[model samples]
Target: MLSDLVDLVLPATCALCHRPGGALCAGCRADVTACLHPSPRPAVPSPPPPGMPSCWVTGEASGALRAVVTAYKDEDRRDLAPQLGRWLAPALRAAVGQDGSARRALHGRGLLVVPVPGSPRARRRRGDVPLLAVVSEAAGGLGGRAVVATVLASTRVTRDQSGLDARARAANLHGAMTVRERQERAVSGAVCVVVDDLVTTGATLAEAARALHAAGAAQVLGAAIGATRRRVLVPANSPGPAG
Candidate 1:
């Protein structure tokens, strides 16, 4: 309520187009939504990271879409979480569909949506793991069918992933995450989909999958709002955005 009051008084402009309204105005929102893949499909990063699970993304990481995500993640635009979470829903739906447990879990079992753990350094600088907030919103939009459960945590500090190649990222994140011991019971039989704001190199998701599986996750999949298209050679028939 207080934030809304502030927004009404200040009238912030769109982060990308800078139109006076919100962090992402309707016009710019439409353009970013246009970039969404229409339907989620497998998104495989170049030289795919080891143990990478099936991943789906809403759009390629670039243009207005990337700007929105970057603003939400790095520019302290926490207000964009709802819009970005809405964008993530499609990919999350696809991921849930792929996980047999999720479909059935809606009946009686529970589906846990987990976000990739960011390093403590990043969290301290960013004020929060923005993805977790986004994932919680996305799960709420899924009705009572799913719930957000942040069971994973960084096991040790690691170097910043920015500018790291696929190999370097894989090495840096290797065993960097683990399911908290106390939370093992919650994850043991849960159908989980590891989520991130964007997929680059697929290293983080792969490492996340490793940790989830280590804790006895019934099934593990990945979904992201966007992915980098750099050198990710998708086959002609693959229904995903690539250039």
Candidate 2:
């Protein structure tokens, strides 16, 4: 198969250390950290610009999760996405369970998994949308009849969020997203789970939740492979300030 050929030519290796084996070597994979059982929280609500999709945040963000996500997104390491997704699968499933307990709850329900659309510039530079791939892979691991939909599009280009503080990152994304009208039907009345590689200040995910709700998604849940920790500041008069 073509996929086998591609794998043959470009063997899988640990994205962090280039150790040959699976997508990641056992040791290196172990090094990739995760935050287990993050408490679910509502996504920070933003004002709808008249007829926008509803959105909600669902997990606590942590520094270790953010680091792994950053390594995957900024480092052009697609191989790591699946591994990261696998690690986060349990948490994602739990979040879904919280919404309902019905059997086949997610089956044939027209669940649309819309990853936060990345900027064209970042996609071009990275060679692919890592978050989309990761979410798709995660869906596969879910081992159910849930369908994954990719219907949203980034209508405007924006600057990369890397290296920017949370405030700046949020400002950079305002009004930078809009769903394609033709693809709007894919999300209508469906349980739309907004996927992202990571969440920091949550501005990006918040905006994405808004766009999906505007598209008529029945319920919008924000899910990321990892959450980012906000930097803490220490006072100048602290007893033991670092040199």
lDDT of 1 by residue, 39-147 (tens): 8867888778889989888888888889898887777788888888898988888887776677787556778889887667658866445588889877786665686
Model 1 residue runs over 4 Å out of place are 1-5, 126-128, 230-243
TM-score of each: 0.88, 0.72
Q: Give the clash count for model 1.
A: 0
Please give the lDDT score at residue 200 for candidate 2: 61
lDDT of every model, 2 decimals: 0.84, 0.61
Per-residue lDDT of 1-243 in model 2, one digit per residue for the tens? Answer: 676688789777666567787766776554554353344443332322222232333334454455556667777666676676675565456456656521244766545667777668667865435477777777675555556666666767778777876567667777677677887877777776667765666778767776777778677766665544435666668787464
Backbone clashes for every candidate come to: 0, 7
For residue 208, model 2's alpha carbon misses the true position, in angstroms, by 0.5
Best TM-score goes to which candidate? 1
